[model samples]
Structure formats: structure tokens, C-alpha cells
Target: MTQEKFEHIYQRAEERKGGETQLENLIYQPLSNDDLRCITDDRWLAGFTEKVFQCGISWNVVRKKWPNFEEVFFGFKIDSLMMLSDEMWEKKAQDPRIIRHLTKVMTIPANAMMIRSARQQHDSFSEMVAEWPSESITELWDYLKKHGKRLGGNTGAYALRQMGKDTFILSSDVESYLRQTGIIDSGRTTKRAQLAANKAFNQWQQESGRSLSEISQIIAYSCGDNRVL
Candidate 1:
């Protein structure tokens, strides 16, 4: 869509609700080395693990247990997490402090190792993400799906957004809207669908001079009544 169409939709939402977009609250600045450093390693894993556990469950449930999650996770420190033994993992899978799903439980250390590997290569997970160009933010989604455990499709995108990467999250509302808008052809998440979605965001960003995060929110507002992550 053109910038005018985008603004018109967002303006209608603004008129109806009289509040700022979540993007405004997010204040997602253009990524840089400084932005990467602003979020430490522990915070990145915390965000990643939260999103991972939140994959198929009610968000409210996750929020409710988040304090206990942090406690069991030892504040998400990688060094401590990397050293957690298998027996501890199995015991924690049966623990009440966090969700007891073993698969999701295993992803914690697997992704910690993923981040550690990225840090060894680039200094930090946020830096690795920050260094990616805006023109191809979707590539990071693909990277995380391929490299990070239990982080495929929408999960990885949500993690990136939580970690403050400027990205377009294809929430249910946003994806449906994109399909209806002719940016995507079908509900199936084929490679072609992703390419089309990526193209549309790239075009919109070029036209509006807005970040992908901004464009995604505007698109959601344009088509749906409420924005979702």
C-alpha cells in the first residue's frame, strides 16, 4: 500500500482510540552497534526463552508464571544455563516453577548455544541481529528457524521483536490482511508467500521511510481492529 493509504487507516485508528501505536511505545530506533550493546546477553535469552515457551500457550499463563520462570532460569544468564546438567533439565521438566514441556525445555540450552556461537562470531546476539540490513529482515527469520532450536515461523519473529529488532511480525491479523490485500496469494506459508510479504514490506518501507516495525503495525491497524504480535 502507498503511504497515504497507510496513514489514512492509522489515522482512523487514532481517531477512534486516541492513543499511540504499540510502535510508539516500543520506540524502536534504527538498529546500530550501540543498540546491540544496550541489551545484554541475559536479556536476549530471557526474551528468546519466553517467546519459545509462549509458542502454543495462552500469553496470560506465560505472564503469570514469568516470575517463577526467571527464578528457575537464574535470570537467564548464559554461563549458568550452559552448565545445567541433563538430570537438572529432566527434574526441571517435572518442576512446577515453569512449563514442564521437555522439548521446549531443551530449546533453552540449544538456543543459548546458538546465541553463544553467534556471540563468538559477532560479539553478541543483538549485535548479530542489529547488523542485518532492513531491506532483508526476513532473512533473520530464516536464519533463526534454521539455526535456533524450536524457533520456526512466527516464534522466531516474535523473539526478534521482543529483543527489539526492527521487524514485521505476521500476526494472524497482519497475515490475513496481507493475503486479502494481494500481497500474498494463499494461507499456506509457502516460500512464495514469504517472498511476497517481504516484497510488500520493502516497497512500503521505501515509500513511507518507516521502519519495518512501523509498517507492520500500520498494516495491522489498516486492516484489523487491534494489533497483535
Candidate 2:
């Protein structure tokens, strides 16, 4: 596949934005404990939980209420959140300050425990992330899908890319661009489709030398979104 087709679309996006664009500007900055003055567990928790809550909901709502979410989850400190009793989460489901999807709310603790477990073995969750294989990033996605709550499919991938992990997110637009460009079959988010997409990206990275983050953003930009919905 020609990278130029994707680049042409992104170039149009650049021109629409008054003739200048930066790939990093269009993507979320990756986070680290040292960079944000936060612990690795907390950092992972934040990205994980945010992706969970944003699923099937307007992302704008999640963005607006995230501060309250941070406060309620004790800045997403793993031990602090683990101490929250079931009754506490029940109360949070009724809290007005945040979206109260009970299942999603409960995932915070499950996810916290996941990071804590990783910390136990790796010294810090960020270290685990750092050591994760970038060349086979889909393996990281598979691990999250198996081990973490609400982390299946795009949610896990979304969290990784949002935290600046060297990964790709198969968001709707990204998938569409892939299909239209003759990279993968169209219809349903299936295992075969995921594997094919991963293979295509692996080849593209080899050919173009772009990070999966930038490549994924380029795919999204190829669909011509100049602004948020």
C-alpha cells in the first residue's frame, strides 16, 4: 500500500488548518511517572479507566467530568482506590459529579489491582510498559484483554496509544480507512480482521519508519476529520 494516499489526506487536513500541521499535535501525548510526577500504577489506571468510561459514550462528557473522576479515585493511586469498599463504589454510581455506570465504576478497582500486580513484579507499571515489545504491540493489547477488566479490543489499544505507548488504536475511522484502502476485509470487529490490520501496520512501519501512534493518527487523518464531532 502506498503511504502517499494516507499522507495526501493528512496534507489536506494540514491545509484546512491554515497550512501547518504536526502529527504529535494531533495525537495525545504519552505519559510517564517521571514526566507527570505520578506513580506508574496511577498513570496506567488513569488511562485505563478513562478508556473504559469513554466507551459507548460521548468523549466530551468524559473529558469534562474527568477532574471529579480524578478526585473521587484519589488521583488514581492504586492502594488508595483499592481501599474503597463496595459500598463506596455503589455511592459513586449515584454521584452527580461523574458518569455513574456501575460496571464501569467497578472496573476502576479491578484495573487498579491489575496495575498493582504488575508493579509487584516489575517495580512499576511504567517499567512494564517500557519493556513491552513495541514491534509486536498487539501482544500488549492481547495481554490487557486477557488480564484487565473492560480492556478488550479497542479499549485496551486506545489506552496504550493514549499513554504514548508504541501502539495503534483500531478506532472506527482508522478501520474504515484501512478497509477502503484494501488493507483488511470490511465487516465486524473479528479476530481475523484484527490480525490482518496488525500485519498491515507492521509492514507499513517497516516501509515508512513511523511509530504506530503517528501511523494510526495518519490513518484517522486520512478520513478527513478537521474537527471533533
Candidate 3:
């Protein structure tokens, strides 16, 4: 179907759920330090590292392994990651606590080095990212395809947005949430569900004057069939 036609269906679906809200209507809940740290890092290389490790695994699994990842990866410090020796790398690969994919495991140190090189040339990771134009969806897609090392794809791009790497929205879970909320009618192929979820979130923000955390709670309550909020 045509994009416009699809969008129309999505709008109809959204109307069935509850319709859209205004910009200032959302209730804002502050993000915790750990949560904020994911986005607010000077380079967001930590998120990149996490994405690298998350290859071929469910995010829930990666979430559980985050502590171990942090410890082994030097808190995702770019400089430290670049400094990892072959022995240290071998030890981390053998560690039972982390995902043990040999190729992905090896890519960590290599990508870290790449990140360092990029940073040296650009003076900052963010600067390197900034060089890519992220204004349009097409641009964002191209940029992601070009620069995303390892096995990351659209899903990874969405994760980067969630981690506050840039301001683009995408995620499968988020799209499911939006589909449930009746924001968008149809989902896109790549992270369409997540895009739908963010669309609903924007709408919720308009209607409730609440933050993402609050919206998350409400969505959870609604989805979980909680009678009492």
C-alpha cells in the first residue's frame, strides 16, 4: 500500500484507541540517573558497546548481562575499551556471565578501536554522529546503514534513539504499545511497532501532561488490565 494510505489507516486505528493529544499536555516524570546516563553520556559509546554485545540475543538477556558487560568493558569507557589486551579479551569471551559469541565477542575490541579512531579524527563521538544528517527518516536510515558497525540494523538505530544517541524514535515493543493504544493503524517493517509506540507516546504527552515514565506506567496499567492506578 502507499505510504499515505497506510498512514490514513494508522490514523483511523489511533482514533479507535483514543486519538491524539497536544504537545504540552503530557505529564513529565524525571528519568533516573542510570536511565539518564544511557542517553546523556558525552559519546554514547556505552550504548554502542551494549548494542554490539546484544547481537543475536534478546534485549532482556542483554539487560540482565549489563552489569557483567559494564565490569568487563570498563564501564564502556572508550579509552579503556581501546586499551584491552588480547589476554583480557580472551578472559571476557570465556566468562559465563556474558554472551559468548566468538565473532561478536571479538568485534567488541575492534569496534572500540574504531570508535577511538573516529573520536581522534572528529574530537568527539557525538561530533562524528553529528556529521551525518538525521533530520529526515531517509537520511537517518542511510546514516545508520553506513556507520553502524557489527550486525546492528534498524533495531539498533531505534535503541540508539532510546538511549538518546539522537532524537529519532523506533522500537518493536514501543510499536506494540502504540498498536494497543490505537495510535497508528499499521506497523512498519523495521521497528514499525516502536515508531507506533512513540507516536502514541507523543499523543499521550499532549493529553495527560505526563512524562515518559508516567506514560509508561499508564500504558503498563492499561495493558496489564490493572483496574486500579
Judging by TM-score against the true structure, name the best candidate. 1
Candidate 2: lDDT over CA atoms? 0.75
The residue-by-residue lDDT of candidate 1 on 1-111, one tens digit each, is 432366665665454444565435633554555776678888878888899889889988998998998898789899998888999988877888788898888888988
Clashes (N, CA, C under 3 Å) per candidate: 0, 0, 16
What would the per-residue lDDT of candidate 2 be over residues 102-157, giving only the tens digit for each residue? 99998888888777787668867777777776677777787788778999868998
Q: TM-score for all predictions?
A: 0.86, 0.81, 0.56
Better of 2 and 3 by TM-score: 2
lDDT for model 1 comes to 0.77
Question: Which has the greatest lDDT?
Answer: 1
Model 3 error, position 85 (Å): 2.4
TM-score of 1: 0.86
- CA displacement after TM-score superposition, residue 50 of candidate 1 (Å): 0.5
Off by over 4 Å in 2: 1-39, 186-188, 224-229
Ranking, TM-score, top scorer first: 1, 2, 3
lDDT of 3 by residue, 1-229 (tens): 2122223433433443454452113323443434543343323656666776665678889989888877766776766666777877887888888777666777666555555565567655445554443233334444444555562455555544555433333345444555554656663444454455455555555555544444454443333332322
Against the correct fold, how does model 3 do in TM-score?
0.56
Let me know the TM-score candidate 2 reaches against the reference structure. 0.81
